[model samples]
Each structure stands twice: as C-alpha cells, then as structure tokens.
Target chain A: DARVTQTPRHKVTEMGQEVTMRCQPILGHNTVFWYRQTMMQGLELLAYFRNRAPLDDSGMPKDRFSAEMPDATLATLKIQPSEPRDSAVYFCASGSPRTGLMNTEAFFGQGTRLTVV
Target chain B: EDKVVQSPLSLVVHEGDTVTLNCSYEVTNFRSLLWYKQEKKAPTFLFMLTSSGIEKKSGRLSSILDKKELFSILNITATQTGDSAVYLCAVEGGGGSNYKLTFGKGTLLTVNP
Candidate 1:
C-alpha cells in the first residue's frame, strides 16, 4: 500500500539548535501540508504547498520556522534555532484535490516527535 | 481564518456503550468535514462528509454532517476497547484554502472492558 514516509521518527534537541524534519508524500499527490500537535494547543496548521508552490504559511512562525517542497516527492519543515516551546509532534499530510463528487482525504505521515529542551 | 471545535475533550465509557462525538466549525465556503482516529501514530481517515444530512457509515462507526447548522456528529455503536483513541475533527475550506484542513483539539475516548 502507498503511504507517506517521514524520517527521524523521534528527535530531542537542545534549545537554540536547528531542527529539520522531512516527509515523502505518496506518489502522485500534489497537495502537502504541515501540522503540529501538542497537549496544550492540540493540532495547528503550520504551512502547506500545492504543486510545489507555497500557498500559505500564515500559521508558521515567520522568523524561525520554514516549510518547503523543493520537489513533488520531498517536503521539508525546518526550524532555525528552535526553542523549547517548539516541542511537538510534527505531521506532514498530502492529498490530491478532488472536486465534484469525489472527496478530498489527506493521508498523514507517521509524524516526527520533536522534543526541544 | 477557518476554525474547528470538538466537544467533550475527553470521555470514558464501558464497552458496548454508545457514544456520540460532536464537531462544529466556522469556515467560509466549507468544502468538507472529516473524521480521523489517532492512536500512537498519525491520524487515520475515518469519514469525510461534504453534504448535509447524508450519513456516512463504516462498520460500527457512522457520521453525519449538517451544513446548515455548521456541525457534525460521529456515532460509535457498541464501542469496544479497540475504539479508544483520539477522534479528531477537521474542516476543509475553500477560497484561499484550496484543500487545507484546519483541525480541532481532538476528543480522547477511552473505552474500558
């Protein structure tokens, strides 16, 4: 079965360290999204890309967080000088837009559990 | 900005009991509402509702959306221990958001045998 793959299932980093998380979406999917899950805030949308173009990154931390999809197969979220508050489970999801009768369902990656100390 | 809210942040029930989880959203040009079950891994797809009053069913789980009321309900019949998980509610919106999903704080369901 086709699935979204993510590298470094777990990471523990000290404060001020740069952290990078990677995702490989399912073949043929064009839409990619980045989400963060935490106990206090639940799930938050950080950024997303459609067709390799950045659509919106309003949810992301403008200064420290960046999300990019250099190519269709690879999507990355990076944090420059990460902080303790950045600790959370980051998820990358992908979906092919389905208009009309078809439904749009996002397939999620296993998620990278990041703990910034 | 699109928003989603789920009720009963946590619930506890005995096996074989029925439960209903609630979700409400305020999104412009709503495209669909989706349900996902999350355990120790990533959230898994459950149901996607795009229309009002249309019930979507899968095994012991069923869900329906009410666009007019801006809410949806997920019903799990005869719940089992395996049904324990965080049920997430998300809304897909239109306009600037092509298919971006805004998620809510999931409802943690614990079914004890």
Candidate 2:
C-alpha cells in the first residue's frame, strides 16, 4: 500500500534551535499540506502546495516558520529560532483530485512530534 | 472567521454501548465536512459528507451530515475498546484553487471494558 512517509518521528530541541521536518508524499499526489497540532489550538493549517508550487502559507508565522516543496517527492517545514510554544505535532498530507470528482481525500503521514524546551 | 466545533470534549462509555458525537460548523461557501480518528499519532480519514440527508457507513461506524443546520453526527455502535480515540471534525470552505480545511478541537472518547 502507498503511504506518506515522514522522517524523524520524534524530536526534542532547546528553545532558539532550528528544527526541520520532512515529508515524502505519495508518488502521484499533486497537493501537499502542512499542519500543526497542539492541545490548545487543535489542528492549524500552516501551509499547502499544489503541483510543487506554494499556494498558501498564511497560517504560518512568516518570521520563523517556512514551508517548501523543492520537488514533487519532498516537502519540508522548517522553524528557525523555534520557541517553546512551537512544541507540537506537525503533520503532512497529500491529495489528488479524483477523476469525475470535485474534491479529493487527503492521506496523512504518521506526523513528527516536536518538543521544544 | 471559519470555524468547526465539536461537542462533549471528552466522553467515557462502556464497551458494547453506542455513542454519538456531534460537530457543528460556521463557514463561508461551505464545501464538505470530514471526520477523522486520531489515536497515538496522525489522524486517519473516516468519512466525508458533502450532501445533506445522505448517510455514510463503514461497519459499526456511520456518519450523516445536515447542510441546512450546518452540523454533522458520527455514530459508533457496539463499541469496542479499540474505539477509544479522538474524533476530529473538519470543514472545507470555498476559496481559491487551494482549498483549506478548518478543524475543531476534537472529541476524546474512551471505551471501558
């Protein structure tokens, strides 16, 4: 079965450190999304890319957070000078429009659990 | 702002019993409602409802949406211990080519044997 693969399932970093999370979306998917999950805020959309192009990153903190898809197979989310509040699980999902369907269902990876001290 | 709300933030029920979870949303140019089950890690897709009055089912888990009321319900019958997890409700809103999903806090369900 095809699945989205995420690296470094867990991470622990001190405040002010830079953290990078990587995701490998399903081979043929065209849309990629990055999300952050916290106990207080639930799930928040940080950014998304369609056809390897950045579509939206409004929910992300432009000062410290950055998301990119350099190529179709790899998508990355990076936080520079990460803060304690940045501790949360970051997930990556991919989807492609199905033939004759208006919307496509997204497939999520296992997620990277980041803990910033 | 677009938002999704789930009721009964936490719940506990005995195995074999049935439980219902509620989700309500207020969004502009609504598109679809989706349900997911989150356990120890990432959430898994459960159901997606776009039309009202149509029910979607998979074994003991089923869901229905009401476009008029802007709400949806998820039902689990003959619950098992494995049913314990956080149920998340998300709504897709119309926008540009990039469609974004807004998710609620999710409802935590615990099934006791």
Candidate 3:
C-alpha cells in the first residue's frame, strides 16, 4: 500500500534554531500540501504545490517559514529562527487529480511533532 | 474569510450506539467536503462529498453533503471502541486557482465498551 512518508517523526529544538521537516509523497501524486495544527489555530494550510510548482504560501510566515517541493516525490517545510510558538504537529498530505470528489481526498503522512523551547 | 466549524467538539458514546457528527462551512469556490478519521497520529481518508443530496457510504460509516445549506454530516452506526478517534472535516476551495483545503477543529469521539 502506498502512503505519504515523513522523517524525524519527533524533534526538539531550542529557540532561534533552524528546523527542517521532510516528506515523501506517494508515488504519482502531483499535489502536496503543508498544514500546521495548534490548540488555538486548529488546522491551517501553510503552503502547497501542484505539479512541483508552488501554488500558494500566503498563510506561511514569509520571514521564517518556507515550503518547497523539490521534486514530484519530495516536499519540504523549513523554519528559520524558529520560535516557541511554532511548536506544533506539521502534516504533509498528497493528492492526485484523480482522487475522490473534485480531487479533495488527500492522503496524509504520520505528522512530525516539533517542540520549540 | 473561509472557515469550517464542527459541532460538539467532543462526544462520548457507548458501543452499539449510533452517533452523528456535524460540519458546517462558509467557503467560496467550494469544490468538495471531505471526512478523515484520525486516531493517535495519521489521519486516514474517509468520505468526500461534492454535491447536494448524495450520500456516500463505506461499511457502517456514511456521509452526506448539503451544498444548499452549507453543511455536512457523518454518521457512524453501531459504534465500537475502535471507532474512537478525532473526526476531521475539511472543505476544498479555490477550484480554479489551486486545490486548497480548509479544515475545522476536529470532533473527538470516545466510544466506551
């Protein structure tokens, strides 16, 4: 069975550190999405790429947070000078145009938990 | 602003009971509404609804979307301890621009045996 894979399932970093999370989308999926979940903010879309090109990153903090799809199979989300408030579970999801109802059913990775102190 | 809201926030039910979870959204360029079952970690895909009055089903879980009312419902029949999890609802919007999903605060379901 194909599934989205993520590395470094858990990480602990001090404030102002640089942290990077990686994801390997299921083979043949053309769209990848990055989402952040917190108690106060719920699930928020940080960025996404379609066909290996960024379609949107407005929700991402331009200064510290960046998301990129280096290749069809690999996507990355990075944080520079990370803050304690940035602590949350980051999820990577992959989808194909042929997916359920209007291509909305996305396959999610077992999220990476980041704790910034 | 586009948003999705889920009701009850949390629920407790006994095994063999039935439960219904709700999701309401106000989104422009709505494309579809999807349901996901999240246990301790990864969220598994459930149902996706795009049109009004059509019910989608898988085993004892079923879902229906009401585009006119801007809401959807997920029904789980004969709940079991294994059914305990967070149920997330997300809306797919910006169909022409790019597929962006706005998710709600999931409903945490607890099924007791």
Model 1 chain B poorest ten-residue lDDT run = B92-101
Sorted on TM-score, best first, the list reads 1, 2, 3
Query: Model 2: per-residue lDDT, tens digit, A20-88?
Result: 999999999999999999999899999999899998899999999999999999999999999999999
The candidates, ranked best first by lDDT, are: 1, 2, 3
Scoring model 1 with DockQ, what do you get?
Answer: 0.76
TM-score of 2: 0.97
lDDT of 2 by residue, B43-100 (tens): 9999988899999999999999999999999999999999999999998875767676
lDDT, candidate 1, B24-94, per-residue tens: 99997788899999998999999999999999999999999999999999999999999999999999986
Spell out the clash pairs found in candidate 3. none
Minimal lDDT window, size 10, model 3 chain A: A96-105
Show the lowest summed lDDT stretch of 10 residues, model 3 chain B. Answer: B92-101
* Per-residue lDDT of candidate 1, residues A12-48 (tens digit): 9999999999999999988899999999999899998
Candidate 2 vs candidate 3, TM-score winner: 2
DockQ of all models, two decimals each: 0.76, 0.76, 0.79
**Which segments of candidate 1 are over 4 A away from where they belong?**
A99-103
**Alpha carbon lDDT of each predicted model:** 0.93, 0.92, 0.91
What value does DockQ give for candidate 3? 0.79
**What is every candidate's alpha-carbon RMSD to the true fold?**
1.2, 1.1, 1.4
Q: What are the per-model numbers of colliding residue pairs?
A: 0, 0, 0
Pairs clashing within candidate 1: none
